[model samples]
Target: MKDLIKDVHENGVKSDYKEPKLYDVVPKEEIAEFEEVMREIIADIVSEASDVACWVYVQKYVKHKPLDDMLQEWSEASQFILAMDTWFERLMAD
Candidate 1:
């Protein structure tokens, strides 16, 4: 490429800017923080839905699911809601 030639001809230097250090990443705690944020988001959505709303979801996903499945889904949904509320409270307080 002409750009490469220009750099060599003009500056007489060689360095690859495209190659980067692999250490420029956050630690595991940062990933945990993101996962917590996602859990909180799911919780808020579950709260807004209010009640075993997974039947519709199952129906949408696979078209017909049992009562037990729906109930379990609702339970998980409630857990997410609680977690989301907690996250929001903490975030807003901060």
Candidate 2:
């Protein structure tokens, strides 16, 4: 949990890391829409999963927001997913 919070705090949305080139193919508006929607979805999942087992939370998370193939190559998006995994793992362990 500490790592999750620390990672998120250190790597907030506006970071020094370069935005993935995947955004180049889409219109800026489209990319912005996707990013906003995905972030909202992620926040919702994390909030709701606060009391569930890892597996159950994962099931709900995936069901609500299945991984989009287009985002597969976006490291920025992937980083958030990875961070959420860590958060969920630690949260569920308790």
Candidate 3:
């Protein structure tokens, strides 16, 4: 995705429309602070999701879950984490 953006900027695609100059909504000086706050928010969400996953795992164990069920639970938790991380990466990229 980054590569595509870079290519569009550098190589001039055949489109007749001109791209508007995108301005920073946040002031340049405050960008670092803004990003730090965003990171904190993302971190909190990720932490909560992790805690929930752990809780679910404990519950399953207490119930004596079968191996297939346990594996499914793990896969779900992993996918959720991966999705959150990917979303964060894209957000930061923009």
Candidate 4:
């Protein structure tokens, strides 16, 4: 997972990545529409992740929650964010 993140960061996201064969069969307009919808979905996932992370941080530091419980929540949130990021990167890539 770390390697995938590093590769994405180093190579950068390829929003335009698409197969030539797909272009031959599918209309460009349809492809554009699909991509737009996908971008919107990814944006929603990122927004939700941001909200979860913020909530977890508040629970841990502001509310003075127990260390073990807070740490577990934090870890889960962090993993979720990372997974979303990786999925987005892969979606944008070939």
lDDT, residue 78, model 4:
60
Q: Best-fitting candidate, measured by TM-score?
A: 4
What's the ranking of the predictions by TM-score, best on top? Answer: 4, 3, 2, 1
Residue range 1-94, candidate 3, lDDT tens digits: 6776787789975546666532346777787888899899999988888775555545444675654564566665656544544554466579
Q: Write the per-residue lDDT of candidate 4 for residues 27-59, one digit (tens) a residue.
A: 877998877888999999888888865665566
The global Cα lDDT (0 to 1) of model 4 is 0.66
Which of the two candidates, 2 or 4, achieves a greater lDDT against the reference? 4
lDDT per residue as tens, model 1, 1-94? 8998898889997867565433345465577787788899999866666543333444334665544554465565655444544554466579
Candidate that would win on lDDT: 4
Q: Across residues 1-94, which tens digit of lDDT does each residue of candidate 2 receive?
A: 6776687798873446666685676777698788888899999877755533343345436655443532353445555555555676687689
* Whole-model Cα lDDT of every candidate shown, in order: 0.58, 0.59, 0.63, 0.66
**C-alpha-based local distance difference test score of model 1:** 0.58
**Superposition error at 72 for model 4 (Å):** 8.6
Looking at model 3, the pairs that clash are none
Off by over 4 Å in 4: 1-27, 67-94
lDDT accuracy of residue 83 in candidate 2 = 55
**Steric clash pairs (candidate 1):** 43-80, 43-81
- Off-target runs (Cα >4 Å) in candidate 1 are 1-29, 51-94
